[model samples]
Target chain A: MSEASTPTPQEDERIKETSALRQALIRPELGGIVGTIAVFTFFLLTAFNSGMFNAAGVLNWSTVSAQFMIIAVGACLLMIAGEFDLSVGSMIGFSGMSIALLSVTFSWPVWLAIIVTFAVCIAIGALNGFIVVRTGLPSFIVTLAFLFILRGFTIYLPQTLERKTIIGGVSDVAQGDWLAGLFGGKILGGLFTWMGNAGLIGVFERGTRAGDPVVDGIPMLIVWAIVLVIFGHVLLTKTKFGNWIFAAGGDAQAARYAGVPVNRVKILMFMFTAFCATVFATCQVMEFGSAGADRGLLKEFEAIIAVVIGGALLTGGYGSVLGAALGALIFGVVQQGLFFAGVESSLFRVFLGVILLFAVILNTYIRRLITGER
Target chain B: MTARSTHAPIIQMKDIQKHFGSVIALAGVSVDIFPGECHCLLGDNGAGKSTFIKTMSGVHKPTHGEIIFEGQPMNFEDPRDSIAAGIATVYQDLAMIPLMSVSRNFFMGNEPTKTVAGFPFYDKEYAARVTMEEMSRMGINLRGPDQAVGTLSGGERQTVAIARAVHFGAKVLILDEPTSALGVRQTSNVLATIDKVRKQDIAVVFITHNVRHAMAVGDRFTVLNRGKTLGTAQRGQITPEELQDLMAGGQELATLEGSLGGTV
Candidate 1:
């Protein structure tokens, strides 16, 4: 018999080294990386003279991206698990209004109100998952119905309680509350103040003492967004639960046959999506100190568009949290860059539509190359 | 071969009957799978082959019958219970996510995890090494354990599924129509893999409609027609042509062939 043709130890090492480069190229996040660089370059060329690359400009876009990333990361996870939570935008509105009405109107403690708001969001999320799994209906339709239901409630709640669609004075209730500081107020406030005093960075003048810079402390929204992205990336790539998510999304029946708890994984994913939406709402309510029924309008579609741009398949089972984070960054850059470039704000939507179309086509082409699909 | 004869059956289905409302999918079928043997369940389409195996694999509960596993009457509420009880069913579709890596697919549900930095993480390195080693034992030299399962040939995919079942402590491996979608070479490769599995002292219930393929690897054969068992035979006791005739409902095909003669 001929000698077996297995690779030698040295040959194996060489093969691994070469395959590493090939592997990196085929990663799902590669498209997002490319798109981020392209968008950053475009903005730098057109809007850099307007201080878009400076510390203050960077802070503005990063803060917006962070808020979007918070929801986009969750949306990315749900998409990877092969589902959608279209009610997320509505959940944000509903959750923000709930907190406002609870703390301001009912005179409840800010902490207690926050907890109740989360509980309500979690229940709504679980219901969405339960109905979808039990009836085997498309999550898109089920969550779409929730979108309207929650939006209607957001508008109706304040009208009933305060005789107006807007709920204000949340800041008054949040004042001196440590929980509010943790969720809403600026982080690194002292450090940024020191930087402003030392003339190292910009700070707010009118909102603070005289001679202060234009931008103050870092937004808590940015911190939460970054934390969520890292948490999501680890959960999707490292844990056994992450593997189950991929399996369930890829093929539910096959996942069940393989002994994966398909239904439970999906339900938990839905709950996580709602939880992220609540977190977004908390940041928004705390930042502005008020909430309207129109809060977070069209934000669900934005998160989904970001996920798709990150190279996640619309069908499911393939995506990256880091990619989704970058996708959110792209959205923030375009949204703010347009203002810096002196372009119409409405034109921002046109740019988003065009980017989403191109990103999806590029993502699909890359996925085909990686999966070797015809 | 004679030594295997003395071993108790790994799984025994006695008078298994499964029905779906007005349709009788399986009407009193029985099968016994012995260790260190490839027991081929031969039948045509709609002969209740899938229904019979689904009962054994715990995909469906037998409407009227008993499944004695390891000499104990077993009732599985889910496929998870069956897997834990050491029965692994590799369905015709293979029940595999194509985009996943070979190592991920190998330990899909039953993953090995190691705690690191106070958190549990999938032991990917160990999984990949084990998957590669196991597939090599079955004579499949994979390019890499991280390669997508979709990129593998039909035979390679089947081998991966079989190896996964074997690695997960499966005492009885039930393969459903594994070679039906494969080419001739891949079919032979799978048959050889079955032989390798049998030598490992695992009971394999290989279900297929192809008589010649069954004759190649099967040590014992069970014929089914009209959702009921026709008979069981030790490999050499039944000729391939006789097995084919029985699988096609005895003399019906022969009579049809006679009547259609001289058509040209």
Candidate 2:
């Protein structure tokens, strides 16, 4: 029996190699990323004539997306860890509203009320996590109930506001500020402002320069988003808490058997997600200089879509925070590109549907390949 | 029993009965496992083999049974309780995450902690070092501890699961069909590990349907049939044919042999 096709000649290394490669690519999270790029390329080819690649196009849509991209990043971590928080949309409104109501109603200092508002948000987020983990109910149910409860209470809050929002003291964060320069620094150049979508990638990169805006370059909100993403990524990839998140999501029973406090991990993930949502709402409210109830509507689905597009699985076990950031970036591009291209906004829904469908199909195909069931 | 077998039985089951709804999974099943002995439990499908192991591992609240450990009679309420009592079961499928690094999968929930409260901090350097050390102790030479458990052959996963239990204070290890899904080489590798387990003085309850494998490691054999114990035999007391004769229910095999015109 020569090495040439001897019967069952043991080491058929090719089969093993192929299966190994298949396993890495088949992961549900990676599937999402590969799927996103595939669909995005197709859209680019078909819609290229729309000038979505131009600066004004980038300016318009990216500004819109950056708002959600900030929150979607956190939502990705929550989903990948096998939990959900539906109250995030509510958290945004409540956090923004709470900050405004506190400053206007109590005549408290702007900075003091802002700090207190976040503290409260973090606590509430933590509470949601604690309850879900202890009760063993799906986080979706828990957070949804949290949403209805918050919504009912939200109407009562605006009564304390002068214009139901536009509170005193913190207007610079949203509207514009000259006093902002006294402390905000000289590097805060006129065109270098973070408030304007006209900054680089969004605004034609040449024209659309911010004429006059207060809170200036690297608005407190954008700075918070970047910091949160970095921290969230570290929390997910480098710590024991991170591993526990994967284990709990991957196999709850086995995780318990291995001594993981699965409930605790789940609760923390939920709370963290809600906290991010609140921060998002607060930041957006600050940018526009007012807290409105209508803010963050439908953002839950968008955040989930971002996560799925980033390559995180809804079923849990595998995901990446960085991938989520990329996913959010993709959304920013498409949305901005379409707006500046002057394509009908209604057609945007059609694009979303197509991209969503493509992402799922490619993700499933990749997962199947990974399992060797394809 | 040899003079070397004089160590007290690590695990002793007495009249253990388990019922799922109305189905009798285990009926007065009893067995004693001594230190340094690879005690084999042989059964066909639906022979209460799983039920018997579940009872020992605290997965089942036995309707009626007494589990004696270290000579003290007790009952375990959950799998965690069983593990705490130094009892661990390795299922045929090997409960380990395939996508995780071997070091991570090895530690899972019991991750070596750098800080002890309000949060868990992974001791990455410690984990990597200990994982490799543990693998070496189990006679597994690998390229690195960072390799995923899924990449290892089937036999390697089984060995890792067993080593994990032993490393974590498991005095009595229950292996559920560890070699059943494995290839020939893999089966031998597991069998060799069982021998290693015996030399380490940890009593083993090896479940299998293969007679040759049981004969290879077992000093004592138990045959279960239809949720009941048929009989038990020492290695010196029965031939391979005799063991199968008992397992198959001699009368049933005889009738089938006669019906086949002596082909058996």
Candidate 3:
């Protein structure tokens, strides 16, 4: 009788334990997850109101994301390696313009033009590396110089390509399938192609007056994104080259002591990042079917944002390839989500800013925790 | 070649002179480090102790005199050459990466690998297995090999570095104040590690300013004062108190002792 009803603190403790078990995760990253959900829901509702879930809407976002994913992968690598390549955005414009001007205006083979363009970009990356290594200059300053110089090149590059004509010619490297397929080409033959890509020709589809024929297979953009992610992850994790990257960023002195040529690694990393930008720029031309001077303007920041969102520490010791992949997806989702929610362009920019700020804070705190624990 | 005798003096430095940028840091210092014996070099701040160790370790190339390692004339341009020559110096700061695992730091640049068609395949499993085996041989019972090195105590970190040198076939291990900053228990642990290392037939050159700690493990003692060796004496030749007197600069010690003025 005494055990059943009176003075039983054990049962009370058990009840208290159950209640405590329901406590929520209050960490900032948890807040990020919650924010992600809230934003996603808000976008879905707007999309429903504005009919953004239509086939056209999907196509639009896919095209935008396809262009972004390739460059974002390289930025992610650089971020994980504890460095930055601010010149990438400029590099793409310059590289693309170089190829287009060479191939279309100069009557050069598309392959040769592409090769020459990439070589120039690689050289620029090496120069950036050499300057960084010799001067111990912060990459931020060096790459920022590239940004302005490249932008200036865009204004004058057309003039150099076609001095006789008053107006410069636009290159068609993007529309060239051979270059596209070589770098990040797509071969799609799947059931999903029934709607996603240009659908089966005349398979009981309405004529132009009655209804538009459905066209679908794989989105070339998705193809580029997938290929880039694979390349980034493998290059970073599975190779000796990747090991060098980790060592170089982790501790330059120790790495050098251990016989890792750190300056060479840095130069290579910059070159690799530039090559990634060129690939991305190539895809942009293919997808858009044209190249211009402002092709890759300010896109470097977007790649950086994706990397930071993906879980890379800025201080050069820890980074993740998968995180960058996920980060790119997150960027896509946010952009589409904003569009679907019927938000104004101004509002979209504001939301992006907020998300970027939150990501920066969370990424920094996690890095601190890791460094402090050790 | 047969290993140096357990009792033979493997490293014998005589009149070692080293200058750094026109500063005569170590001037005419001599010490004999015998296999299987713990030799201590004791001195106060700026007492040429660091310079002596640097000269021995090949960090700073000596200006004059000889460093005989395993009965060979030694001139090491860098620490890597010295390490290869079986003379290992563990710096005070300990160059192990804090974020890396104990096993990774144990092997570090000299990680063991198996060759597959002339290509190196880093046998990670073998490294883990051997890191455990070697560390246990050094009398360290760690929780796990995968544990981050920063988790270990100062003494344990020193032991790990010492154990690495031993496993890599270092005949003469020079510890640069390895236990100076460690707490009492940790320092004792280091002394025990030094003892274990001595049993393995390695000659240890223990550098420190503390007489008590030095006396705790020293087989032969050398004290330096102001860029020169005051004297090098076998432990049996001089009492600890006398050693302490010499290290404290006997003139100041005498003044303090004289104040007691025949009170006894």
Assess every candidate by TM-score: 0.95, 0.76, 0.78
lDDT of 1 by residue, A124-146 (tens): 99999999999999999999999
Write the number of the candidate with greater TM-score, choosing between 2 and 3.
3
Model 3 is docked with a DockQ of: 0.14
Worst lDDT 10-window in candidate 3 chain A? A7-16
Ranking by lDDT: 1, 2, 3
Clashes of 2: 12
* TM-score order of candidates, top first: 1, 3, 2
Taking chain A of model 2 alone, its TM-score versus the true chain A equals: 0.78
lDDT (0-100) at residue A296 of candidate 2?
A: 67
Off by over 4 Å in 1: A1-22, A203-208, B257-264
| lDDT tens digits by residue: candidate 1, B1-264 | 677788898888999999999899888988888988999999999999988988998889999999999999999998899999999998877567887888888899988899998889999899989998887787776678887777667887888889888888899999999999999988998898899888999999999999889999999999989899998899789998788889989778777757878231
List of chain B TM-scores, one per candidate: 0.95, 0.92, 0.90
lDDT of 2 by residue, A1-374 (tens): 36764432244344544555654665545644664576468557866767555544444444555666678777877786678778888787788778767765676665666678778888888888888777878888988998877765565667544545334345744233333222222344465444354544332234464354422344454456567778877777778788888787777766776767877787677767777887776666555566776566677778887777766767776677776776676677666656555668778778777777776666656544433343
State the TM-score for model 3.
0.78
Model 1 docking tier (incorrect/acceptable/medium/high) = acceptable
Instruction: In angstroms, give how far residue B243 of model 1 lies from its true place.
Output: 0.8
